[model samples]
Target: MNYLCEMSEDKSANEVRKIIHVDMDAFYASVEQMDNPDLIGKPIAVGGSKLRGVVAAASYEARKFGVKSAMPSSMAARLCPELIFVRPRFDRYQEISHQIRAIFYEYTDLVEPLSLDEAFLDVTTNKKGIQSATLLAKEIRERIYQEVGLRASAGISINKFTAKVASDVNKPNGQLTVIPEEVETFLEKLPIDRFFGIGKVTATKMKELGVRTGKDLKQKSIDFLNQHFGKQGLHFYNIVRGIQYSKVKPNRIRKSFAVEHTYFSEIYSKRKILENLEQIALDLERRMKKKSVSGKCVSIKIKYADFTQQTRAKTVLEYMSTKEEFFPLIELLVEHLEINKPVRLLGISFSKLNTEETELDQDKQLTLQF
Candidate 1:
């Protein structure tokens, strides 16, 4: 896809920020392939087996067969009959993630981790004194591969939104850069669905409204967009114009800790569901203890086979961290759920944490600082 756009003569006099978004290529699947030499170049899925499991990640080879993460394993197996399924090793993934973050610290401390596999970095004033953001991205990617044996793709631009969208343009060990002057045209031609916050549902809605690309979106007035998308309409309005000002915050606080799992098959038996919930509780307890924090509220999420989901939460008088202390509460919560239908997923989470409580506003919008 062509990413170039005609440059505007009058560039903004404001200080142009340098942002880079780095995303690991098929992270979990890649790790599986890297550790297992025999799995190289083979179509493998890092998840559960075909009968009753869900896919966590799929290697590029498997992707050719239309397999994807979060897809049901049975469908993935049908798509690629030769697909190999392997369980995810999150501990190992976390270990490697730390190594990659350390490399980012070598250049800039303004690293904002979105997940274990992706992050946003602000390197406008990097410690390395590198004038070119593209070169810095290349160096970071090279270091990750050489040191950690994983391939990564990067996108370099003047802001986080453009940089993030550019990262996916070239994938599986490639990089893309969207210079400031080209940002307008680059966004105009971009597919509506390709924008960072627009998902399938919203993209379908936009297409129904004759907004197929960024150019079409830009044609709508802020009032029109707001009328349709509510508050997010303002977000859509600004992003299409390359007007994003969200900073790459390095020290983002963690609000909650949770653990969840999708079963290989629909579980009909309450006893079986309880068994799974017990294991989930144990896992969550371990994570809480590791962080040395306890929470007053316990929450459980249940997803039925029909794709419907519900969450139930209860707050206790005192902080609790042990499985023994919370498992009974979980049982009580499960009793209230509509389990007449078979359950496909179960999760447990702890909130109202004993750690410093920061009431983060979910809808807070950020503007340009300087």
Candidate 2:
């Protein structure tokens, strides 16, 4: 069924900004695959194998043989003897990226492109004039698939830092979101390396300092972190606590959200699963409030014992009005369940929020996506 949300005019509501990071899957390689049907399943490399030349893109198949973009062509050749190298088609790839951007503009005027293959968009006030960010995302992805014939992954969050990282998690045509309400727990289970700004050097130092996940960093005093990393200490302190007040700059959209949970003995009970729903609901609610916004739609995600996952969401009558009110509706949704199998994880999301700062147009366009 098509996803839908109903939202009243939130004229009194404060606006919450968003940053969405989008990346083309295998970029040039994917383009090649789309152009030539034969290359779809083959180990295709779009670049030179000559001395000093670099690979631009490698199909997923080619990646299995250790081929990677921006890597020396010689290394790629040495790793995969059967690799089929193709020259870069600048015009074609550029055309594809351009088409993708046009779709983005449909959502928001605040678009900041990172590179030919990636971009960040601030959809607080979308051009399509839709209020639900998730629904807009679904529409965007569908458009890219139909119009560009390429798969793109997206990461969405209240800020740029986490959103950029979220896009890379379930890559190659996947879209993920990290709701502000769930930021803390989301970061708690997150690996340190995945945290924004925790690069190789920082990651090493973080390990030494006992700062592993965002939650671990939360344990340290802000002053303590400042002593070790100087200005970055304050930065770490904020992000670890999921306090990314950062805006979705039009020029630098990176990626989307990351969400996972810890399990005790890999649970598999419906009642227990419903109980966990409250935790995820709380998490999502907190993240949303921190960003000073609410979503118009709620989704319940389930991960079964076999690792199979299914998600169901209903567009709501309003943005998350209050946590006290939101949880019960989620409870009602849980009752609609009919999973005959054991459950592992249960997640709930409030999306398609009316959080943008724009005058409500009389010509509202209703769409089903969030």
Candidate 3:
């Protein structure tokens, strides 16, 4: 009787705020379904209005046929002949994103949005005082579906990295949580490729050094890992230990937001290169609009067919968010670029975001405290 009473008392006294990450699966396609009932049963792909356009999202039905985002629309069609490609409606997407953000704010202002479809919320001392994070994730997912006609995946863990990874374990309305005791063991046996922060380039490098699994990575000395891969090696070390302290940055500053694309065949002509940059500038404009900021610095990235890369940046006289002004910055970037080498990829980024206050530099750089 004494032990039971103590347990009950502790449960009431020990109130810890829980952080939860919620990610919508195929968010754009889901929104399309919500708008059009006929599209619900069909395989949908969002984006691809032009011949040069790419797929921004693919529904689960189309995913079975290997369709994916960032893939060329032509290639996606080749892969899934039945795929229905639609032009992106940014207004609709933004409206839905706002609705989701509003829901998160209703719970806690501790919400840190990673993207339109993904966010982390800290509800440690919330009004609801919910105990189970898993149940909370379920309720949030249900609310999203019922109110917005969308599906979302959720991950609940002690920190952001683990929660983000756990959210992907099950997709398309899935929710998973990392119980405290199981975290370490679960990370140890995980494949290096699946480990957070290990991108394709790093994975290839790790394989060359015989580090295929998380267990394999666990064997390496910090000195050895750092000597080879720089600070990223330190990241590998922490994740293996199942100790990531990275906080959900309340509002990550829009510093140098850009998109790049690699061509199957490199282009040699200057006019063609300028045309491609124009397209990238348009995408940059869209992203800047979404982030709600104008940037004073515009930079361009160029990669050669030989894998050699170069970047040029210029601090403009003033902030600009529209494509009209942003393109001139690209023109300035092209002025300094070398045309001798064929262009494999082209990218554009804008930095020095303008908001009510310029304090974003420090907050945006909030170290992933692992």
Candidate 4:
């Protein structure tokens, strides 16, 4: 059923932001095949041979067999008996990512990387003096193929979120453009699950709320959404109406260090929830140590059996880099939550970050003063 609504007064149809999203097609697997011709046309998964390891990337051939990234190696092997597992070469991926970024810089310096495989570029004004963002997308994709020896897909839209969603419309090296006037029509027919910020859990919740399409989502009152979903509710209210104002934030700072655990079975016990939270906190601590950074805010995310999720966060007086500093705060956050329903997921993230300070040598401070 199509959910229908009149255009909200908050939305505008002006095509102000010319955004392009470029996504490399099956990047890691494709790179492996490129370097080793024998692997071409074969079903391969890149991650590792370890049975417990997860698939980091799957070739198109592997994907056809229901193999996918994050699938355990053992399960992938079961699904595709001939699936070849290759260790991830992150160094190589980084090198290739640099090459792609160089190509982007040649066109526009407004590139914002989503990952090694995908990025958003605002080419409303470009270095090449090109007027059509659509044409520039085509050129960038061609350059990636010719110079980087990889196929890339492009999506051109009025904004970043729509551009990101459009890029997935025709995958494995294709382009789609959503023009200024077509934004509403484009979003109206799109599935709720395909909306940029909505995850699987959120999509399921939306489906339960009779919000199956962007049109359906638009029908809900902003107050009703905010009452149920908090700040994200307002975000959904805006996006469905094509009201996103998020710019392509270049050099976006890392806001949080997080880790989560999805339980195989629903967890009902508060003690078990705390245990899981502790492990996640320890993992986050390790990650922060490795990065040599810390933050003042600690947040706990909980997803219930019904797939409804909530997060509670607090900013403390001092930088928190270890479990000892975060666990108590997490405990306080959890105390306020209603965990009557079985918990499906638990996570901890540290935000409002700061780099740990090292005392400067007195002589260095004096030299700087001089």
Candidate 5:
């Protein structure tokens, strides 16, 4: 079919789509709980307990006491004096993540992973030929529990945003489906804060402007919103009208591979900066190989102590995958830049991607885990 005809067919298909958003319940903390029965039903957090450290994940029990992920551990401690803290086991989590991803692939290839814990799946045309999305969601959740021993919440809707929001409506081992006919009503009653992409600051600003709910937001003129919130204003306008058109990208194609590190203290020594750059190059090399991608363009980003940032780039003669080929260009780029102030951050990225997927054995994939 021609591209335009295909798009017209896609639009019609979308009207009856079966998009499912699946989110693992308290993934990190739940993994910790499942491995240790003694930790079940107890207030536990997975992350460092040091004053400067942040909570990586909080169990449902800890959440009752106002402890949440990314909150300072000290604050979490104050919230629940008897809170038990466990260090994050990222390798274990990643392994479980891959296992869960395997289950997703059994259902549909149109899976877009939002994180290690959540994903969006377009199952309109699924392998199982299941007609009802609600039934498919139930089966998926059941399989996850039986196979992975983890509870997953699911949401089914005609589009991604609605499906994502509905997933949270009934969380921690629950599911909800919003049918095509109810899309407008569902969004209208939803609080502005509950809409994806509208953060605390924006929510507060919206409240002050009488944009308290999707219904309120829908009443505002696009030009007025555009004048106030720039391009995002138009986005808000469209989504409130149930007009989100983003697709589920399964391959998870990456445009660039990069690694960055921020130093607590600024460094003026050229030797220290170069050392950091070299390390970053190695890290980027590992990331690229993991994703099975390389690029012809290379770039380096430098942030000064004053928070000023600059990026320098070069289109190399060939696609480069190893750090050895890119290190010399990185050095040259750093040398060419004006460095009157100490450096606070350094980063390296490779763009203009080569799309060929790298075939790796199971052992190689395991070794490539970050």
Candidate 6:
């Protein structure tokens, strides 16, 4: 099923965009390996080894043993017995990220950084006047290696969605290009689970409906999709046909800062819940302080053993950053929560951030469709 002819007829798709998504090769784990020569070529996990700790990132060697980010540290250790765990150095990572972004600005100002490790660059109009985005991506990756001492991978395509997905096709210091003509076949053959935004739950639901691939998804009627997925139905319809319009916004403001933990064992006691909340509050405070931001709203997220989740929030008169300022409010919110069910996860988030007032411009805040 080709979409090129139909896309060319649409005014919104008239402009042929050139976007490149560059993602670092296992960023956190790679940084650890680079800094410490002794850790080279070894399976390493960057995170805590304590009980209830999650793997923040895993080196490629560790990944061979099925260790992955967000996996329980104990599970990761069980997977790879020799996996060396290293603490994350955010300050060091941020320092390196700044240097990498500087390299991106040399080519184009339309750089949308998704994280410290990956970003989308709209090189349709660039400072270097580079016409071939594939060539430009190669150059950028090469520059990142030469200047920053880190290997990077890139994907070049007509839009950000396809570009981002294509980047993962050839990873760990490699590049891929999904040209304008190839986007249709590329998406059609792709598994529904590999469609970037689709998670495990959604993919399982798609499979249950006999939609295992993009080809299968394209066969379903818009009405049928809407009935099942609601508003996101149109999103699936458009993206599969290569019709994403989300631009690479230069200034992407973070809306909130949160800290969450899924416990190794469920906590049924109120005292245990409060103890966990206090620990989460300390982490949240440290993060907020590092960002030098405060918020008026404090929220607590609770997930039960049954996988049901609930959030309780309280808004205060003034912005607060310290745990002391917000912990009491968190305690108050927790007091109202039902404790009949065992809780598997607990989280704390600060919203209505002070940074929003200073950094946000309503007109520039474009919602990413994907």
Best by lDDT: 1
Please identify model 4 stretches exceeding 4 Å from their true place: 1-15, 257-352, 355-370
Clashing pairs in 1: 52-264, 53-264
| Per-candidate count of clashing residue pairs (backbone under 3 Å) | 2, 26, 4, 0, 0, 0
Give the alpha carbon lDDT tens digit for every residue of 1-370 in model 3: 2222221222442333366889998999888877888888777789763344467898888889998887777788888888887777778898999998877777777889887889998766555667777887788889888887788999887767778778888887898888777776777777888876788999999989999988888898877888998867666776776556555567655566778876655688878889998988788788778878788888888877555788988897788899998787688778777789777778888777686346655555665442
Model 1, 1-370: lDDT tens per residue? 2111222222442768999999999999999999999999999999879775778899999999999987888899999999999988889999999999999999999999999999999999999999999999999999999999999999999888999999999998999999998998999999999999899999999999999999999999878987999978778887788876677889766677889888767898878989999999888888888988788899999887667889999999988999999889999987876678888899999888876443333323222332
lDDT of 3 at 296: 84
Model 2 lDDT, full chain set: 0.72
By TM-score, how accurate is candidate 4? 0.71
The CA lDDT at 123 in model 5 is: 95
Better of 1 and 4 by TM-score: 1
Considering TM-score, which of the candidate structures 4 and 5 is the better prediction for this target? 5
Query: What ranking of all candidate models by TM-score puts the best one first?
Result: 1, 6, 5, 3, 4, 2
The sequence of per-residue lDDT tens digits that candidate 6 reaches over residues 254-357 is 78889988765669988999999999988888988998989999999998756678999999899999999999998899899888987878999988998888
* Backbone clashes counted, model 5: 0
lDDT at position 303, candidate 1:
85
TM-score of each: 0.89, 0.60, 0.77, 0.71, 0.78, 0.82
- TM-score, predicted candidate 3 vs. hidden true structure: 0.77
Model 6: per-residue Cα lDDT at residue 347: 95
The CA lDDT at 53 in model 6 is 59
- Taking all chains together, the TM-score of candidate 6 against the true structure is 0.82
- Give the clashing residue pairs of candidate 6, or none: none
Q: What is the lDDT of residue 353 in candidate 5?
A: 74
Candidate 3 C-alpha error for residue 364, in Å: 16
Clashing pairs in 4: none
Candidate 5 lDDT over residue span 128-232, tens digit each: 999899999999999999999999999999888899989999988999999888988999999999998899999999999999999999999877887889878
